[model samples]
Target: MPSAQSAARPAARSAAGVLGLAALTLLATAPRASAAEGWSLAPAGDGRPSFYAEGAPGTVLQDTVSVTNSGSHPVTVRLTGTGTGTGTGTGVPVTFAEPTVRVPARTRADVPFTMTVPAGAAPGDRSGTLLAKDADGRTATARIRLHVGGPALSALTVEHVAVHGDRITYDLVNRGTTVLVPKLAVRARGLFGRVLLDRAARTLPVRLAPGTRTGLSEPWPGRPALDAVDIRLTATAADGAHDTAGTEARFVPWGAVAGTAGALTAGAAVTVVRLRRRRAGRPAEPPPTDTYTDRDRDTDRDTDVELTGAVR
Candidate 1:
C-alpha cells in the first residue's frame, strides 16, 4: 500500500502538467501582432481613405494629414506631397505647414497642407500622394485626388498633313480643356479629279490630352505609281471638335523617265554621227561660167569690117 503523502504528490504533478498544456494551447490560438503596426499615416478626421479637392485654376485648397505613432518610443517623420497622372501638368503643388513632425508614443500629429491648382491648369482630374517616412526607412502614404474646374471646351485641329512613300502623315492638336480620342477620315484625289483613296471615319489608337500634339500616319500600300495627289485629313472628336487639313504630292516613276531620256539621247547621237559621215563623203563644187549668143558674134564682125574701111 502507498502512503498518503506519495499519492498526493503524484496527483499534484498530473494537475500541473495539464495546466501547462492548457496555457500553451491558449497562446497558440491567440492572433499574432504585425511588425509594421508601430506607425501609420492617414487623412485627418471623418475616416476618409483619401483627400479630395475641387477648385478653379489658381485656386488654393487646404487639407490635413495625420501621422500616428503607437510604439513605446517617439517617432520623427518627414512629410512630402507628390503629384501623379497626365492631367497634372507639372505636379501637385503641395505645401506643408510642418514638413517634419515628431510624435510621442501613442500620439497622433496632424499636419496642415495647401495644394494650389496651377494658374493655367486645364480642367481635369489629377491624382497625387501624401507620404510620411521615418528614420528606419519605413514609409506610409495617403492618396490625394484633385479636380480642376473650368469651362469645358472641345476643340482640335489637324495640321502638317503630308504624303510619304506609301503613307499619309499628319499631326493632331488638342486646343481645348478636355481630353479627346479623335476619329480620322482620309481622302485623296488625283490630278484628273479621280478618287484615289476614300476611307471612312474611324477611331484612332490615340488619346490626346489638352494642349497636346501627336503625329500619326496611315498606311497606303496600294497607292498610285505616277500621279499628282491631293491628300486631305479630317479629325473629329466628341463635343463638336472637328478640323481638316490638306496637302499636295506628286509621284514620278524615275526609272521610266530615265529609260526614255536614254533612248532620246541615243537617237540624237546617231543623227549627229550620220551628218558627220555625209559631209565627209560629199564632193567639192567648181567656179561659175558665162556663154554668148550668135547675134552678139555677128555684131562684133560688122564692127570690125567698118573699122578696116575707115582706115583705107
Candidate 2:
C-alpha cells in the first residue's frame, strides 16, 4: 500500500496539471486582454481614398474600401459614408448598418461602403472614419475624407466630328478628373443611325490638364454620313490614376462636305488630262489644201480614160 504522504503528493500533482491546463484554455479564448489586444486595419496601400462632388439633397454615392487583417487574429470592419467628397458622409444616426465582416488573419477583405447625403446637406469637405472593430470591441480606424464639389458631373457631350477627308476628330474633356487615360472604340453612325464604324484600340493615352480638357481630331474610314454623330469615351486609370469618367459628345459632320468636294475635283482634273493625251497619240492627218490637187486631178482622170480604152 502507498504511504499517505506519497499518495497525497501524486494527487496534488494531478490537480496542479489540470488547473494549469484550464488556465491555458482561458487565456487562449479571452478577448484581447491588453491595450495591444486588437486587430489592425491594414490598407493594401490604395492611397487615401475619397469621392468628392457637388450633390443635391438625397444623393447616393457608392465607393469600395479594401481592408487587410495584417494581424494574427481576425477582424471585423464597419462602413458608413456619403457619396460626395464632403458633408457628413456618414448619416446623422451614423452607423455602418452592415453586418461585421470577419477578415481572416493575414488576409484581405474588400468592403463596399455607401454614402447618402441628406437632402439639405451643405457642400464642402466632410469627413468620417471607417471603424475596424475586433471581437474584443477594440477598434482601428481609417479616416474617410470626402469632398463636395460644385456638382456631380452627370452627362458628357463630345461634339464636332470635323472630318478632314477620311480622318476623324476628337476633343476629350474629363469634365471631372484631372486627366483620364481612356480606351477608344469609335462607332460611326449614318443618317439612319446604323453603326458604320466599330473598332477597338487597346488604349488611347489621354492627358487632360486639370480643370481644362484635351482634344484630338484624327479621321478614320467607314464613318457614316450623318448631320452629327455620338462618340463614346471609356477611360481607366490605375490605383494612383484619376477617376473613371465615361463621356460622350454630340458632333456635327460639318467639314465632311469640304473633303468630299475636294476629292471629286481632284479626280475629274486627272481624267481630262488623260483624255487629251489619248487623242494626241493618234496619227496626224495631212494638209487638205490643194498644192498639186487640181492639176493632178485632171491628169489622173485623162490617164484613166486612155488606159480604159487601150485595155478594151
Candidate 3:
C-alpha cells in the first residue's frame, strides 16, 4: 500500500493545476503543523501564510519553507520558485539548499533557501511563489515578497511637449524610485508680454509608477488667433520633485498685415513727392534794379565824346 505522504501528493498536485494562475495570497495552503488534508505547505512562521524579506541590492537573504505531510504515507517532493507577476521586473533569484526532500507521515520538513537581490536591482518590491511538487504531480505553494531597500526618490520630468490645435500634449516620466501623484501648472504669454493664461497647479487624476512614462494633455480653450505665444508647464510631486518645460506658437493674419503696410507706404511716398513739387514751382525773386540817374548818363556820354576826338 502507498504511504500516507505518497497518496496525498498526487491529490494536491491535481488541485493546484485546477486553481490555475491564482493570486499569490490564494496559493498559500494550511500551515505546516495544522494540515487538515494529505499534505500542506507554508512559511516557517507559526501564523504567517507568506514570506516577506528585505535587503539591499547585491545582498542575499535567508529564509525557511515547511512542507507537512498529514497523511499516513511518506512523500517525496521537489522545490522551486516562480515569479508572481512582473513586479520590480525579472524577480529576485530564489535558490534552495536541497531541491528534493522526503517527509514522513505526520511530519514536516523545513528547507532553507536564499533569495539573492541582483546588483542592478532597482529599489522596489518584488514577489514570487515557493512551490512544492510531489511525485504524483500534486503541488503546494507559498507566496514570497522581497523588498529591495534604498532611499525613496521622487524625481520626475515633462517631455515631448507640443501644441496641437487647441490642446497641449506632453509626456510625464518618473525618474526616481517612488510612486508619484503629480500636480501641473500652466502659463502662457502673448505678443507685447500679455498674460494669456495663468493656471495654478492642480492634482492629476492618474498616478505615475517608478520608471514609467505616460502621455498627458492640457486644454487650451482660449488659444490666441492672431498673436505669437510662449507656453510653459510646471510639474510637481508631493515629495518635492519638480520640473518645467516650454514651447512657442505663433498665430498671424498674414493677408491683413501685408495689405496694410503696402497701403501706408504708398500714401507716404505720394505726400512727400507733392511737397517737393510745390517747393520747386515757386519763381526766384528778381534782383533790385538801380535807378540810373539822368545826370549819370550825361556824364558818361561826355567822357566818351572826349575820348573819340583824341583818337581822331
C-alpha TM-scores of all predictions: 0.77, 0.30, 0.59
Error of 1 at 79 (Å): 1.7
Weakest lDDT window of 10 consecutive positions for candidate 3: 21-30
Give the alpha-carbon lDDT of every model.
Answer: 0.76, 0.46, 0.75
lDDT of 1 by residue, 85-178 (tens): 6552445788887898888887777676778888989988787788888898888887777778788899999998888888888999999988
The reply for model 3, stretches above 4 Å from the true place, is: 1-37, 45-48, 72-92, 97-107, 124-128, 131-140, 252-312
- Top TM-score prediction, candidate number: 1
lDDT for model 1 comes to 0.76
User: Compared with the true structure, what per-residue lDDT tens digits does model 3 show for residues 198-217?
Assistant: 99999999788778899999
Question: Could you tell me the TM-score of candidate 1?
Answer: 0.77
lDDT of 2 by residue, 1-312 (tens): 211111232343355355431110111221221112434442222333332223344655444344555667665655433222323233321333243666666666554344555664433446555556555666555544434344433222344445565676655554442233555555555445656566664566554332445677556665444545544443344323323222233444569878888887776676656656765896886665757688877996997577545433
Output the worst ten-in-a-row residue range by lDDT, candidate 1.
21-30
Give Cα distance to truth, residue 135, candidate 1, Å. Answer: 2.4
Cα error of candidate 3 at position 167, Å: 2.4
